[model samples]
Structures are given as C-alpha cells and as structure tokens.
Target: MIDVAEHLAAVLEAARPLPAESHDVAAARGRVLRHPVRAAVDVPAFDSSAMDGFALRFADVTAVPATFRVVADLPAGTDLDPTLDTAEAARIMTGAPVPTDATAVVPFEDTERGLAGGLDPVTVVAAPRAPGAHIRRRGSDVSAGDLVVDAGVRLTAAWIGAIAASGVGTVSVSRTARVAVVSTGSELVSPGAPMRRGQIPESNSVLLAGLAEESGAEIVLRTSVPDEGDGPRRAIAAAEEAGADVVVFSGGVSAGAYEVVKNTLGDLMRFDRVRMQPGKPQGFGVTPRGTLLFGLPGNPVSAAVSFELFVRPALRALEGDAEVGRTSTRVALAGGWRARPEKTQYVPVSLDRTDPAAWVARPTERGPRGLGAADGLAVLPPRESDVAPDELVTVALW
Candidate 1:
C-alpha cells in the first residue's frame, strides 16, 4: 500500500495551472487573477468636493463672517474649472470638481444662508479647520500605477469593486477548469428508480459534481454507467468531446473481480491502495489529451473523504491558486475511541467552537449519525492503541 501523502503528491504533480486569459472585471469574479491589476489613473482623477459647500482659498476664511463674491456654481459630475479672485468662492455640490485655486471647503450649514446661499454674494458664519478640508484630493484613495490587486488572488465582491475603481476595464485570470463526473457500478440506479434487492441508488455523481463546482470547476458532463460493456469508455469519450479537463470516476478502482474502470483505463491510469482507512483504493492518471482522471471508492463517506484529501487541492492548483489544501486546525478530542490499526483513520466529527481557543472535536458514530452530522474530520494518525480523551490531533474542516 502507498502512503497517503505520496499519492497526494502524485496527484498534485500532474495538475498544472491553466493558461491566463483576459476577461472583463465583471466576468472575472470568482476567478484567480493571473497578473497584478495596476491603476491606470487616479481613483478620483481630479480634485473634488466632499461636501456641498463653498470652494474658496483658505487664506480668505481664517476669520468668521468673511464675505466673498460667489463666482461659479459647480455640481457633481461637472468639469468646469472656474477662476476665482481674492475673497471669491464657488458654490460647489458634493463630488463636484473644485476650482484650481481653491484650497478648502466649508459646508453650506456653516454659512449664514446655508442652502439658501446662491451663485452670488454669501457670508461665511464659520471657518474651515484647515486648508484642503472637505476635499477628496486626486489619487487620495489610489494613485496611477498603484497595484490595486495582486496576482494569484481570487476576485470577490470587494476586489471587483477595487478593479472597477482602478481604471482597469479588463484583467488577466486563470482559465476555468471543465470537469466531468462518472460513476461506475451495474447495481447502481438513479434515485427514485425502481430498485431490486441487489440494486442501490447512484449518488456519487451528485457528490463529486457539487464538490467540483465548489472548487471553482465547471461541470461539463455527468453520467453513470454499469460495470459491463463499453459504457465507461463511452462516457469518457463524451467528456473529452465536451472539453473536459478532468474526469472523476467512482467505484471501479478496487480489487473487485468486475472493476470496469480499472480494466478499461488500465493502460492510461495506475491503481493504488493508499494507507487510509475506508478510501484506500485509488486510481489516477493524465490522458494523452492531458485530461486528468480520478477513481474514488463507492461508499459516499469514502468518496467524499478521498475528494477532500486529493481532488480538491488539484482543482484549486489548476486555477493558479497558491494555497490549495484544506484548512486544517489542531483541536482536542472531547472523547476518544479505538483507532484502526496501522492505517490513517479519518473520523467524522462535530466541532464545538464556542470556546474558540480550546476547540473540542466530538466524534460521531458511523452510519446515519456519522458523516451527515459532521462539519470536519479529525485526522487520527496510524496507531493500534485507543486514543485518550482530550488528546490533540489535526482536523480538516469542510
């Protein structure tokens, strides 16, 4: 049997970062940026008023009740640069461009007439605290040629807004991965189908498809085929025709007599028994066309755990993300149980995070109360002895 970490290393080695392509910032949301986004122009582009008030030279406002001749009326979005003489001012609205000679702004409420102040004579009842007060100077938020967003970072809502304000209309981002999910087993039938004594519902496709999408991959194809005939090969052909970059197959990599996936793709992929309980049988390979292939266990819990340990990180790396592994944290066990001998055991657990500094992981029993109720898995190391209560171990949160 192969070590789990060795198998993971092999999977990641086969995954490559997709080529970068230009995309509109709106279309690039949730994609990893391939290049740094530098501001082409200042955020504000020009000096503007932050309040509806008088835009005048500060030298004319050191004393209260200073009188001035309002020379111009500037509203938001107007580009007029009116000239001002000594003791002259402009009646400016919020977001309007200030005159070139203006050094400060005092709100209309600070003036005797307040909003009644017109584009003419007005008296200031209060003085501005300092020069350039209430003014959003050019480049104050972002300057030209500033790095607004760094490379390899995923674009979220906040990042999208920053890109929009950075004067960059288009950005380079990693290409989205097209994934296909195929589940192999003759006894498996679709949910709600009439099932005989030996038949079971085919649910691995749904599980793998959702996990693939959550990792930033687009599901290009999904199919379920039996162990007999050419069904598995046909499904893979369809996936390739649909431009799939990865194909995940479940239930046919084990040492069963009728292992369809292992038999059909044996020439391209290599099957391995990883030293991990419940999901040890694994298969992985890159096809001639460079599409990755993965084979997982049939059991739902095993399939999910295998995906979390191997597939998720590969998918993330394909999108150029630097951090690809699940976020693992050390937590103390609320209670302990005997561990599987000589095999890495992943036990479903519910974490008590109320005491954040001292998180306690409670192991749930296998079956209905196990994986379904778990938000994480406490990764118990390979050992034959029973784990003691309050022992510290690493847990990978979903």
Candidate 2:
C-alpha cells in the first residue's frame, strides 16, 4: 500500500512532455504552446480611425458651428491617402486609415447632414476637445517582434485572436497526447445492445475517453474486451500499434481470481493500493516501447475519481502544462457524515452558491445520481470518526 500523494508524485515524475509540433492557428485552441509566439507584424499596421466621422485638423473644429470643405471620402480598406489641412475635413469611416496631418475626429452626429447627404461642404457643430482623439495609433497594441504570448500558455479564443492579429497563421504547440481507452469485462455490453442475464452496459470507456479529451489528450482508440484468455493482451497490443502514448484500462486491476489485467500485466506494471476511498486499487507502468499504462478500478464512480486524481495530471504533464491539478477552494461543510479511518476520501458534493464568499458544501452519495448533481469533489483527509457540520474542507472543482 502507498499514500495517495506518493502515488501521484511518482506518476508525475514518470510523465514527460511530448515533442512539439506545428499546428494551424485555427486548430490550436486548448493546446499548450511549446514556444513563445512572437508578433510577425505590428497590430493596426497603420494609423486608423476608431470611429466613423470627419478627420481634420483640431484647429478646424476648435470653434462650434464651423464649416470646412470636405476634401475626400475615406472608407475602410481604401489605400488613398488624402492630407487634411486647416478648414478642411475628410469623411472617414471606422477602421479606415487616418490621413497625415489629421489631429482629431468629429463624429457625424455633431453635423447637421450627419452622413445622410453630400459632404462637400460639411458643417462641424461640436469641436473635438483635444488632439489625437479617436485615432488608433499604429503599433500601439503590439509591435513587430513583440512577445504576443509566452510558452506554456493554454490557447483560448482570445489568444487565437491575438495570434491572428499579429499576422501569424501558424503556431508551435505541444503535441496532443494520444490515448487509448480499454475497458475490461466479459459481462459488459455496449449501450443500445441487447443484454444477457449477467450483462451490464459498458460505460467506462466513454467516461474515460471524455475525461482524457478534457485534459487535452487525443483519443486514438477506444474498445472493450472480455476478461477471458488473451483478450486484454491483444487489446493492449492494438493500442500500442496505433501509436498511443498512454493506455488506460478501467477494470480487472483488483485482487480477484478472474482479474485479467492483474493476472496478465502484473509482471510488467506496479499495482498498488493507495489509501483512498472508492479508488484504492491503482496501477501504472511504462511498456518497453515507452508507452504509459494506467489500470483503474471497475466501478463507475471509482473510475471517474481515479482518472481525476491520477490520469488527468499525467495527461497534463505530457502536454507541457504548468498547472495540472484541478482548481480547489476551501468551503464550509453543510452536513456531517462518517469517514473511513486511515484513508482519504473524495466525496461528491454540490455547492450552495447563495453566499459566494461563504460557499456551503452539501455532500452526496457515491452513486451516479450524486455524481450528476456534484460540482466538485470534497477532499476529506483521514479521520478517526465522523465529521461535523460547518467544518472547513477543501473542494476540488471539476
């Protein structure tokens, strides 16, 4: 038997970041950047207008009810450059390049015509208070060769927009970890299929594959095999041939006579009983070909908990993420319950958000019904007896 912390530490130490790969910026969302992304060109490559209005010298609009000759009309994406002089203006649209000598912009709302009619003889009723108003200066947001985003950043929508704004069409990101999910049990059948007397719907593969993708791992293969002879071994070989970086087996890891995973792969992997509730039997090892393997418990809740605690972090590490664990918060317990002695327990909980600053955790059962309503897992340390209400506990948000 080993402590939970010790097992996690070992797993993280064994996992290393995969090699970097280049990907299109459009397909780079949710991937960790392996190298810093530098701006290829200055943002707003040229001085542009921030509003649709008249672009003229500030002196022309310093006085109210002033008239100026409209020199030219500048719409967006136009390449013509018309200079603005005293008592002269240009009808400019939003995102249009600002002409040289233009110090201010007066919106059409301040004029009587208001872009509804001809602009040869435009009237400026209000004066722009200061110079350089309503102008988005060139290179103001980002300059050429500037560090747009640093390495190890998880790409989000905003990050993608920034990268595109920098004129970068492609980016270097960490390779997605290829994963294979193998659910072992002879009595399991696929959903929507006819079930026999001792058959149950196989759901662990779906659960594990979803969790793997959420951690940024790409699902390369997902299959279920029986506990009979050579079934588990053949499934593992198929995964290895598919170029999987990690193979996760959801059952046959416990101490039982018909434990296919234990009886077959026990010599190649290290199986340990971590001091944790619902997911104590855990196994992990690297094959001779350097592919990682994880053997989790059979129960649905136990498999989910084991993936969250052990497999998720390993996948994150493989993707070069600096922060791998789920976000945790200290909250007040809404009720009391008995806890197992000398074992840490991860109890499903629903948060009472009426008072956000003082969140209350309502415990739920260890079944699928409770899991459906749970927003997080309450991490309860080993205790001699039952815990009381109002006690503070750390809850790891999913």
Candidate 3:
C-alpha cells in the first residue's frame, strides 16, 4: 500500500512532455506552445483613422463654422498619403491611414454641407475634439518583436486571434497525447449485447474515452478483453501498433486469483494498494514501446476519480502544460458523511451555485442514481472522521 501522492509522482515522472512540432496557427487552438510567439509586425501598422470622417489639422478647426477645401479622398487600403496644409481637409473613411500632419478626425455629421466629392468645399460646424481624437497610433496595441504569446501557453480563441493579428502564421507546440483504453473482465459484455445470468454491461472504456478526450487527448483505440488466454497481451500489442502514448486498463488488477491484467503484466507493471476507498488497487508502469500504462479499478465511480486524480495530470503534462492538477475551491458543506480511517475520502457531490460568492456542496443522493447526479468531488483529508454540516471543505469542480 502507498499514499496517493507517491503514486502520482511516479506517474508524472514517466509522462514527460511529448516532442514539439510546428503547426499552423489556425489549427493550433487548445494546443500548448513550446516556443514564444513574437509579433511579426506592429498592430495597426501605422497611424490610422478610427472614424469615417475628414482628416485635417486640429489648428484649422479651432474656430466655429470653419470652411475648408477637400483636397483628396483617402479610403481604407489606399496607397496615397496626401499631405494636408492649414484649413485643407481630406475625405477619409474608417481605418484609412491619417495624412501626415493631420491631427483630428471629425465625423460627417459634425460638419455642414458635407462633401459630395473629394474636391467639394465643406464647412465644419464643430471644433475638433482635441488633437488625435479618433486616430489609432502606430504600434499602440503591440509592437513588432513583442512576445504576444509566451511559451507553454494553451492556445484559446483570444490567443489565436492575437496570433493572427501579429501576422504570425505558425507556432511551435507540443504534440497532443494519443491514448488507448481497455476494459478487462470475463463477466462483462458490450452495452446492448445479450447478457447471460452472470454477464453485465461494460462501460469503463466509454467512460475513460470521454475523460481522455475531454483532457484534449486523441483516442486512438478503445477495446475490451476477457481475463483468459492472451487477450490482455494482444490488446496491448494492438495499442502499440496504433501509436498510443498512454494505455489505461480497467479492472483485473486487484489481488483476486484471476486478475488478468496484473497476472499478464506483473513483470512489467507495479501493482499496489493505494489506500483510497473504492479505488484501493492501482497498477502503473511503462510498456516496452515506452507507452505509459495505468490500471484502474473497474467500478465506475472509482475509475472516474482515479482518472481525474492521476491520469488527467499526466495527460496535461504530456502537452507541456505547467498546470497539471485539478484546482479545488473551498466551499461550505451542506451535508456530512463519515470519512474512512487513515485514508482520504473523495465523495461525489452536487454543488449549489445559486450564489456566485457562496457555494454549497452536499453528497449526492446515494446509489447509481446519485452518482449520476454528481458534478463535483469533495475532498476530505485522512483521519478526519464524522464530519458535521456547515463545515468547510475543498471540492474539485468537474
């Protein structure tokens, strides 16, 4: 038997970050970058107009009802940088670069006799609203050579948008983990399949596959094998051939005489009692092909908790992410239950998020139905037995 932390440390040590590769920024969302993304050009590129108005010197519009000659038309994407003299204005559209020496932009509504053409004369009805009122300065948002996105960042929509705005087309990121899940049991049958008196529906592979995909992994294989002959060995061989970096096997790891997974992989894996209720048995090792192996208990609740605690961190670490563990927030207990002696307890719970500031948690209504109701897991420390209501505890929100 071992404490949970010791087992987790071993798993993390084996699950080093995968090699980094270059990917186009458009396809890199949710991937962790291995190199910093520096801006290729300045944001805004040059001083541009922020409004569709006339671009003129502020000194020319200081007086009321000022008249000016519209010298040139400057629409967005124009190559002309027409210089404006005193009292001379240009008809400019939004996003057009401001003419050199121009300091303000007044909307068409702010002027009387608005220009029907670039050469038409117009009268300004209002004074310019201070210099540089509606001009976006060059390099104002970001400068060339600036680090827009740092290394080890998980690219999100905003990050990708920033990358695109920086004119960077590609980024270096860690390759995503490829996972395979296998469920082992002689009495288990596929869901919706005809079952005998002793046979039960298999569901661990589906559960693990969903969990792995939720963590940003690509599921390469999902299979089930009975605890006899060479099924376990053959499944592992198939996973290796499929290029899986991690293989998670469910069941057949306890001390039972017919523990197929442990019996077959005992020379390669190290099985132990992990001192956690409902999930005491744990087995982990590296395969000959270098794929990390994790053997979890078959119970649905135990498998879910084990995956969240140990396997999820390994998956994140494989992506070079610094944050590899679940974040638990403190919440008030709405109900209490007895904790196991000398072993930490992870009770499935439902959270009352009625108030954003004050969250309340209570144990889900017991049984499979209650387990289905759970959206969180309340963590109670070891030796803390017989908890009372209204007490404070930390919960990991799903």
lDDT of 3: 0.89
What TM-score would every model get versus the actual structure?
Answer: 0.87, 0.92, 0.91
Order of the predicted models by TM-score, top scorer first: 2, 3, 1
| lDDT-sorted candidate list, best first | 1, 2, 3
| Clash pairs (backbone) in predicted model 1 | none
Evaluate model 1: give its TM-score. 0.87
What value does the lDDT take at residue 166 in candidate 3? 90
Each model's number of backbone clashes? 0, 0, 0
List candidate 3 segments past 4 Å from native. Answer: 107-129, 366-372, 383-385
Q: Write the per-residue lDDT of candidate 1 for residues 37-146, one digit (tens) a residue.
A: 99999978899999999999999989988999998899998979998899999999999998999999989989988768577688999999999999999999999999
lDDT of 2 by residue, 225-339 (tens): 8888977678778998999999999999999888888889976789999999979999998888888889999998999999999999998899888788899999988877677
Error of 2 at 20 (Å): 2.2
